[model samples]
Target: MPRPTPSPRPRRLGVAAALAVALTLVGGCGTTSSSGNLKVYQQEQFEPGETFSRMFDASVSQTCEAARRALLSQGYIVTVLRPDAINGSKNFQPGGEAHVQITFNIVCTDDGNQGKLSSAYVSATQDRYTLKKSPNSASVGVSAIGSLSIPFASTDDSLVKVASETIPAGVFYDRFFALMASHLKELQMDAAVD
Candidate 1:
Protein backbone atom coordinates (compact mmCIF):
# COMPACT_ATOMS: atom_id res chain seq x y z
CA MET A 1 0.00 0.00 0.00
CA PRO A 2 1.20 3.54 -0.88
CA ARG A 3 0.05 6.98 0.53
CA PRO A 4 -1.23 9.45 -2.07
CA THR A 5 0.83 12.73 -2.26
CA PRO A 6 -0.92 16.12 -1.94
CA SER A 7 -1.12 18.16 -5.15
CA PRO A 8 0.58 21.64 -5.42
CA ARG A 9 -2.57 23.19 -6.97
CA PRO A 10 -4.63 22.32 -3.87
CA ARG A 11 -1.97 23.89 -1.60
CA ARG A 12 -2.09 27.08 -3.62
CA LEU A 13 -5.89 27.10 -3.46
CA GLY A 14 -5.78 26.68 0.34
CA VAL A 15 -3.45 29.68 0.65
CA ALA A 16 -5.73 31.74 -1.58
CA ALA A 17 -8.76 30.75 0.56
CA ALA A 18 -7.01 31.80 3.78
CA LEU A 19 -5.95 35.08 2.18
CA ALA A 20 -9.51 35.76 1.07
CA VAL A 21 -10.83 35.21 4.60
CA ALA A 22 -8.18 37.50 6.10
CA LEU A 23 -9.03 40.22 3.59
CA THR A 24 -12.76 39.92 4.39
CA LEU A 25 -12.16 40.24 8.13
CA VAL A 26 -9.91 43.23 7.67
CA GLY A 27 -12.43 44.97 5.40
CA GLY A 28 -15.29 44.52 7.92
CA CYS A 29 -13.20 45.99 10.76
CA GLY A 30 -12.95 49.41 9.04
CA THR A 31 -16.72 49.97 8.66
CA THR A 32 -18.86 51.86 11.23
CA SER A 33 -22.60 51.88 11.82
CA SER A 34 -24.33 54.86 10.23
CA SER A 35 -27.45 54.92 12.43
CA GLY A 36 -26.67 57.52 15.04
CA ASN A 37 -27.66 61.17 15.59
CA LEU A 38 -24.77 63.58 15.90
CA LYS A 39 -24.86 67.03 17.34
CA VAL A 40 -22.34 69.88 17.56
CA TYR A 41 -22.26 72.30 20.49
CA GLN A 42 -20.75 75.75 20.23
CA GLN A 43 -20.27 78.37 22.93
CA GLU A 44 -22.52 81.39 22.97
CA GLN A 45 -21.03 84.67 21.71
CA PHE A 46 -22.30 88.09 22.72
CA GLU A 47 -21.55 91.31 20.90
CA PRO A 48 -20.32 94.17 23.06
CA GLY A 49 -22.54 96.76 21.45
CA GLU A 50 -25.63 94.61 21.87
CA THR A 51 -24.88 94.10 25.53
CA PHE A 52 -24.36 97.74 26.62
CA SER A 53 -25.33 100.06 23.77
CA ARG A 54 -29.01 100.17 24.56
CA MET A 55 -29.81 103.85 24.28
CA PHE A 56 -33.22 105.39 24.73
CA ASP A 57 -33.80 108.79 23.29
CA ALA A 58 -35.41 110.07 26.43
CA SER A 59 -34.57 112.09 29.51
CA VAL A 60 -32.81 110.55 32.55
CA SER A 61 -35.88 110.77 34.73
CA GLN A 62 -38.03 109.21 32.05
CA THR A 63 -35.52 106.44 31.37
CA CYS A 64 -35.15 105.61 35.05
CA GLU A 65 -38.92 105.50 35.39
CA ALA A 66 -39.07 103.14 32.47
CA ALA A 67 -36.50 100.89 34.11
CA ARG A 68 -38.42 101.02 37.38
CA ARG A 69 -41.60 100.04 35.60
CA ALA A 70 -39.83 97.24 33.79
CA LEU A 71 -38.39 95.82 37.02
CA LEU A 72 -41.72 96.03 38.80
CA SER A 73 -43.41 94.14 35.99
CA GLN A 74 -40.97 91.26 36.40
CA GLY A 75 -41.59 90.81 40.15
CA TYR A 76 -38.49 92.79 41.16
CA ILE A 77 -38.66 94.64 44.43
CA VAL A 78 -37.32 98.12 43.77
CA THR A 79 -35.15 98.80 46.79
CA VAL A 80 -33.31 101.90 45.65
CA LEU A 81 -34.51 104.51 43.16
CA ARG A 82 -32.63 107.59 42.05
CA PRO A 83 -32.45 109.96 39.14
CA ASP A 84 -29.67 108.00 37.44
CA ALA A 85 -29.74 104.55 38.97
CA ILE A 86 -32.19 101.78 39.82
CA ASN A 87 -31.73 98.72 42.04
CA GLY A 88 -34.08 95.78 42.30
CA SER A 89 -34.03 92.30 43.81
CA LYS A 90 -36.05 89.11 43.70
CA ASN A 91 -35.94 86.09 45.99
CA PHE A 92 -36.77 82.47 45.27
CA GLN A 93 -37.24 79.52 47.63
CA PRO A 94 -36.94 76.50 45.37
CA GLY A 95 -37.00 73.73 47.96
CA GLY A 96 -36.17 72.85 51.52
CA GLU A 97 -33.22 74.77 52.99
CA ALA A 98 -32.45 76.48 49.68
CA HIS A 99 -32.78 80.15 48.94
CA VAL A 100 -31.74 81.99 45.74
CA GLN A 101 -31.82 85.64 44.88
CA ILE A 102 -30.91 87.87 41.90
CA THR A 103 -30.32 91.55 42.25
CA PHE A 104 -30.36 93.93 39.30
CA ASN A 105 -28.42 97.18 39.36
CA ILE A 106 -28.83 99.58 36.47
CA VAL A 107 -26.82 102.75 36.21
CA CYS A 108 -27.87 105.30 33.61
CA THR A 109 -25.49 107.87 32.22
CA ASP A 110 -26.73 111.28 31.23
CA ASP A 111 -24.06 112.15 28.67
CA GLY A 112 -26.11 114.99 27.26
CA ASN A 113 -27.75 113.35 24.25
CA GLN A 114 -29.16 116.83 24.05
CA GLY A 115 -31.24 115.54 27.01
CA LYS A 116 -32.40 112.95 24.54
CA LEU A 117 -30.32 109.81 25.15
CA SER A 118 -30.00 107.83 28.35
CA SER A 119 -27.82 104.72 28.44
CA ALA A 120 -28.35 102.10 31.10
CA TYR A 121 -25.54 99.95 32.43
CA VAL A 122 -27.05 96.59 33.26
CA SER A 123 -25.59 94.04 35.68
CA ALA A 124 -26.90 91.29 37.91
CA THR A 125 -25.65 89.49 41.02
CA GLN A 126 -26.87 86.00 41.85
CA ASP A 127 -26.73 84.83 45.47
CA ARG A 128 -27.54 81.47 46.97
CA TYR A 129 -28.27 80.75 50.63
CA THR A 130 -29.05 77.67 52.66
CA LEU A 131 -31.14 77.51 55.81
CA LYS A 132 -29.38 76.47 59.00
CA LYS A 133 -31.60 74.91 61.63
CA SER A 134 -30.65 75.62 65.25
CA PRO A 135 -32.31 74.25 68.34
CA ASN A 136 -33.35 76.63 71.07
CA SER A 137 -34.74 75.94 74.54
CA ALA A 138 -37.71 77.72 76.04
CA SER A 139 -38.59 77.77 79.73
CA VAL A 140 -39.66 74.16 80.45
CA GLY A 141 -41.69 73.40 83.57
CA VAL A 142 -44.80 71.52 84.68
CA SER A 143 -47.46 72.92 86.94
CA ALA A 144 -50.00 70.44 88.13
CA ILE A 145 -53.60 71.52 87.46
CA GLY A 146 -52.23 74.77 86.09
CA SER A 147 -50.38 76.11 83.05
CA LEU A 148 -47.74 73.64 81.87
CA SER A 149 -44.62 74.81 80.04
CA ILE A 150 -43.21 72.60 77.27
CA PRO A 151 -39.97 72.70 75.24
CA PHE A 152 -40.30 74.74 72.07
CA ALA A 153 -40.80 72.59 69.03
CA SER A 154 -40.21 75.54 66.74
CA THR A 155 -36.70 75.66 65.27
CA ASP A 156 -35.02 78.91 64.27
CA ASP A 157 -33.81 78.90 60.70
CA SER A 158 -31.13 81.31 59.55
CA LEU A 159 -29.87 81.75 56.03
CA VAL A 160 -26.22 80.94 55.47
CA LYS A 161 -24.58 82.46 52.42
CA VAL A 162 -23.25 79.83 50.05
CA ALA A 163 -22.28 81.34 46.70
CA SER A 164 -22.46 84.54 44.69
CA GLU A 165 -21.65 85.31 41.06
CA THR A 166 -21.79 88.30 38.77
CA ILE A 167 -23.70 87.59 35.60
CA PRO A 168 -21.93 88.62 32.42
CA ALA A 169 -23.44 90.78 29.72
CA GLY A 170 -25.44 88.93 27.05
CA VAL A 171 -28.97 88.27 25.79
CA PHE A 172 -29.94 88.29 29.45
CA TYR A 173 -30.11 92.07 28.90
CA ASP A 174 -32.40 91.98 25.87
CA ARG A 175 -35.54 91.90 27.94
CA PHE A 176 -34.44 94.89 29.98
CA PHE A 177 -33.82 96.85 26.80
CA ALA A 178 -37.14 95.86 25.33
CA LEU A 179 -38.95 96.93 28.45
CA MET A 180 -37.14 100.24 28.48
CA ALA A 181 -38.01 100.85 24.85
CA SER A 182 -41.69 100.34 25.46
CA HIS A 183 -41.64 102.68 28.45
CA LEU A 184 -39.67 105.26 26.49
CA LYS A 185 -42.29 105.29 23.78
CA GLU A 186 -44.98 105.83 26.35
CA LEU A 187 -42.99 108.61 27.93
CA GLN A 188 -42.59 110.32 24.58
CA MET A 189 -46.29 110.12 23.99
CA ASP A 190 -46.92 111.63 27.40
CA ALA A 191 -44.52 114.46 26.71
CA ALA A 192 -46.06 115.14 23.36
CA VAL A 193 -49.42 115.53 25.04
CA ASP A 194 -47.93 118.00 27.53
Candidate 2:
Protein backbone atom coordinates (compact mmCIF):
# COMPACT_ATOMS: atom_id res chain seq x y z
CA MET A 1 0.00 0.00 0.00
CA PRO A 2 1.20 3.46 -0.89
CA ARG A 3 1.66 5.88 2.03
CA PRO A 4 -0.63 8.95 2.07
CA THR A 5 1.11 12.00 0.59
CA PRO A 6 1.64 14.90 2.98
CA SER A 7 -0.40 18.03 2.25
CA PRO A 8 1.38 20.80 0.36
CA ARG A 9 -0.55 23.49 2.30
CA PRO A 10 1.65 23.17 5.38
CA ARG A 11 4.83 23.49 3.37
CA ARG A 12 3.46 26.54 1.57
CA LEU A 13 2.55 28.23 4.83
CA GLY A 14 6.07 27.69 6.21
CA VAL A 15 7.62 29.24 3.13
CA ALA A 16 5.27 32.23 3.34
CA ALA A 17 6.07 32.77 7.02
CA ALA A 18 9.81 32.73 6.35
CA LEU A 19 9.48 35.17 3.48
CA ALA A 20 7.44 37.62 5.60
CA VAL A 21 10.03 37.59 8.39
CA ALA A 22 12.91 38.06 5.98
CA LEU A 23 11.19 40.99 4.34
CA THR A 24 10.47 42.60 7.69
CA LEU A 25 14.11 42.35 8.76
CA VAL A 26 15.35 43.71 5.46
CA GLY A 27 12.92 46.65 5.55
CA GLY A 28 14.09 47.66 9.04
CA CYS A 29 17.68 48.03 7.80
CA GLY A 30 16.88 51.21 5.90
CA THR A 31 18.15 54.49 7.34
CA THR A 32 14.77 56.14 6.77
CA SER A 33 11.25 54.83 6.87
CA SER A 34 8.91 54.54 3.88
CA SER A 35 7.19 57.71 5.05
CA GLY A 36 10.41 59.58 4.19
CA ASN A 37 11.97 62.52 6.09
CA LEU A 38 10.53 66.04 6.13
CA LYS A 39 12.23 67.36 9.24
CA VAL A 40 14.02 70.11 7.32
CA TYR A 41 10.83 71.69 6.06
CA GLN A 42 9.03 71.15 9.36
CA GLN A 43 11.76 72.95 11.31
CA GLU A 44 11.38 76.19 9.44
CA GLN A 45 9.69 78.92 11.58
CA PHE A 46 9.49 81.56 8.77
CA GLU A 47 10.17 84.42 11.13
CA PRO A 48 10.72 87.77 9.39
CA GLY A 49 14.36 88.83 8.99
CA GLU A 50 15.46 86.13 11.40
CA THR A 51 18.09 84.64 9.14
CA PHE A 52 17.61 84.83 5.38
CA SER A 53 16.54 88.41 4.85
CA ARG A 54 17.25 92.01 5.83
CA MET A 55 15.69 95.39 5.25
CA PHE A 56 17.51 98.29 3.64
CA ASP A 57 16.58 101.97 3.52
CA ALA A 58 17.25 102.31 -0.18
CA SER A 59 15.72 101.60 -3.56
CA VAL A 60 15.52 98.06 -4.96
CA SER A 61 18.09 98.76 -7.65
CA GLN A 62 20.50 100.27 -5.15
CA THR A 63 20.08 97.32 -2.81
CA CYS A 64 20.78 94.83 -5.57
CA GLU A 65 23.85 96.76 -6.65
CA ALA A 66 25.13 96.59 -3.11
CA ALA A 67 24.53 92.85 -3.05
CA ARG A 68 26.50 92.45 -6.27
CA ARG A 69 29.46 94.37 -4.91
CA ALA A 70 29.38 92.40 -1.68
CA LEU A 71 29.56 89.07 -3.52
CA LEU A 72 32.32 90.32 -5.85
CA SER A 73 34.37 91.46 -2.86
CA GLN A 74 34.36 87.87 -1.61
CA GLY A 75 35.71 86.52 -4.91
CA TYR A 76 32.39 85.00 -5.92
CA ILE A 77 31.77 84.68 -9.65
CA VAL A 78 28.60 86.54 -10.42
CA THR A 79 26.39 84.42 -12.66
CA VAL A 80 23.22 86.47 -12.77
CA LEU A 81 23.01 90.22 -12.42
CA ARG A 82 19.84 92.24 -12.53
CA PRO A 83 18.37 95.34 -11.01
CA ASP A 84 16.34 93.35 -8.49
CA ALA A 85 18.07 89.98 -8.43
CA ILE A 86 21.63 88.71 -8.24
CA ASN A 87 23.25 85.27 -8.13
CA GLY A 88 26.85 84.38 -7.36
CA SER A 89 28.87 81.25 -6.69
CA LYS A 90 32.24 80.48 -5.09
CA ASN A 91 34.26 77.30 -4.92
CA PHE A 92 36.29 75.95 -2.02
CA GLN A 93 38.51 72.94 -1.53
CA PRO A 94 38.38 71.59 2.03
CA GLY A 95 41.02 68.89 1.34
CA GLY A 96 40.65 65.12 1.01
CA GLU A 97 39.73 65.36 -2.67
CA ALA A 98 36.50 67.07 -1.69
CA HIS A 99 35.09 70.19 -3.29
CA VAL A 100 32.44 72.61 -2.06
CA GLN A 101 30.49 75.28 -3.85
CA ILE A 102 28.43 78.00 -2.24
CA THR A 103 25.89 79.84 -4.35
CA PHE A 104 24.19 82.99 -3.18
CA ASN A 105 20.81 84.26 -4.43
CA ILE A 106 19.51 87.69 -3.62
CA VAL A 107 16.22 89.39 -4.45
CA CYS A 108 15.35 93.00 -3.76
CA THR A 109 11.85 94.44 -3.53
CA ASP A 110 10.15 97.60 -2.43
CA ASP A 111 9.04 97.62 1.22
CA GLY A 112 5.74 99.53 0.74
CA ASN A 113 7.57 102.80 1.49
CA GLN A 114 7.60 103.98 -2.13
CA GLY A 115 11.14 103.84 -3.52
CA LYS A 116 12.87 104.89 -0.32
CA LEU A 117 12.64 101.55 1.54
CA SER A 118 13.48 98.09 0.24
CA SER A 119 14.23 94.58 1.43
CA ALA A 120 16.95 92.26 0.28
CA TYR A 121 16.23 88.58 0.74
CA VAL A 122 19.23 86.30 0.55
CA SER A 123 19.62 82.52 0.52
CA ALA A 124 22.73 80.45 0.01
CA THR A 125 23.13 76.77 -0.87
CA GLN A 126 26.22 74.67 -0.24
CA ASP A 127 26.97 71.72 -2.48
CA ARG A 128 29.63 69.14 -1.65
CA TYR A 129 31.25 66.96 -4.29
CA THR A 130 33.75 64.13 -4.17
CA LEU A 131 36.06 62.69 -6.78
CA LYS A 132 34.84 59.41 -8.23
CA LYS A 133 37.02 57.20 -10.42
CA SER A 134 35.67 54.57 -12.79
CA PRO A 135 37.93 51.98 -14.35
CA ASN A 136 38.28 52.09 -18.12
CA SER A 137 37.05 49.01 -19.97
CA ALA A 138 37.80 47.71 -23.44
CA SER A 139 36.05 45.00 -25.46
CA VAL A 140 38.25 42.90 -27.73
CA GLY A 141 37.04 40.58 -30.50
CA VAL A 142 38.79 37.22 -30.77
CA SER A 143 38.32 34.47 -33.37
CA ALA A 144 38.03 31.67 -30.80
CA ILE A 145 35.98 33.64 -28.30
CA GLY A 146 33.01 35.69 -29.36
CA SER A 147 34.18 38.73 -27.45
CA LEU A 148 36.09 39.46 -24.27
CA SER A 149 35.67 42.52 -22.15
CA ILE A 150 38.62 43.69 -20.06
CA PRO A 151 38.99 46.49 -17.55
CA PHE A 152 42.19 48.55 -17.64
CA ALA A 153 44.08 49.83 -14.60
CA SER A 154 43.46 53.36 -15.75
CA THR A 155 40.37 55.14 -14.39
CA ASP A 156 38.37 58.19 -15.42
CA ASP A 157 37.91 60.72 -12.66
CA SER A 158 34.91 62.98 -12.15
CA LEU A 159 33.32 65.08 -9.49
CA VAL A 160 30.20 63.49 -8.05
CA LYS A 161 27.92 65.60 -5.90
CA VAL A 162 27.33 64.02 -2.52
CA ALA A 163 25.38 66.44 -0.37
CA SER A 164 23.62 69.76 -0.64
CA GLU A 165 22.11 71.99 2.01
CA THR A 166 20.98 75.54 2.41
CA ILE A 167 23.21 77.68 4.58
CA PRO A 168 21.30 78.40 7.74
CA ALA A 169 20.76 81.94 8.90
CA GLY A 170 23.57 82.83 11.33
CA VAL A 171 26.91 84.59 11.43
CA PHE A 172 27.41 83.76 7.75
CA TYR A 173 24.46 85.86 6.73
CA ASP A 174 25.11 88.47 9.41
CA ARG A 175 28.55 89.23 8.04
CA PHE A 176 27.17 89.44 4.52
CA PHE A 177 24.55 91.93 5.60
CA ALA A 178 27.13 94.00 7.42
CA LEU A 179 29.35 94.18 4.38
CA MET A 180 26.41 95.09 2.16
CA ALA A 181 25.44 97.84 4.55
CA SER A 182 28.93 99.32 4.40
CA HIS A 183 28.91 99.27 0.63
CA LEU A 184 25.53 100.95 0.53
CA LYS A 185 26.79 103.60 2.92
CA GLU A 186 29.76 104.25 0.71
CA LEU A 187 27.54 104.59 -2.33
CA GLN A 188 25.37 107.09 -0.49
CA MET A 189 28.41 109.10 0.53
CA ASP A 190 29.70 109.09 -3.01
CA ALA A 191 26.35 110.24 -4.31
CA ALA A 192 26.24 113.06 -1.76
CA VAL A 193 29.69 114.29 -2.79
CA ASP A 194 28.72 114.25 -6.44
Q: What's every prediction's RMSD, in angstroms?
A: 13.0, 7.0
lDDT of each: 0.82, 0.91
TM-score of each: 0.65, 0.72
The positional error of residue 47 in candidate 1, measured at the CA in angstroms, is 8.2
Which 10-residue window in model 1 sums to the lowest lDDT? 33-42
The model with the greatest TM-score is 2
In order, how many clashes per candidate?
0, 0
Expressed as tens digits, the lDDT of each residue in 1-194 for candidate 1 is 89999889999999999999999876765553233323212233455554654677787888888889989988999999999999999999998889999999988888685888778888889999999998766654557665554567788889999999777667778877898789878878988999
Which residues of candidate 2, in runs, are more than 4 Å off?
1-38, 137-154
> Per-residue lDDT of 20-92 in model 2, one digit per residue for the tens?
9999877764534456654465667888656688989999988898999999999999999989999999999
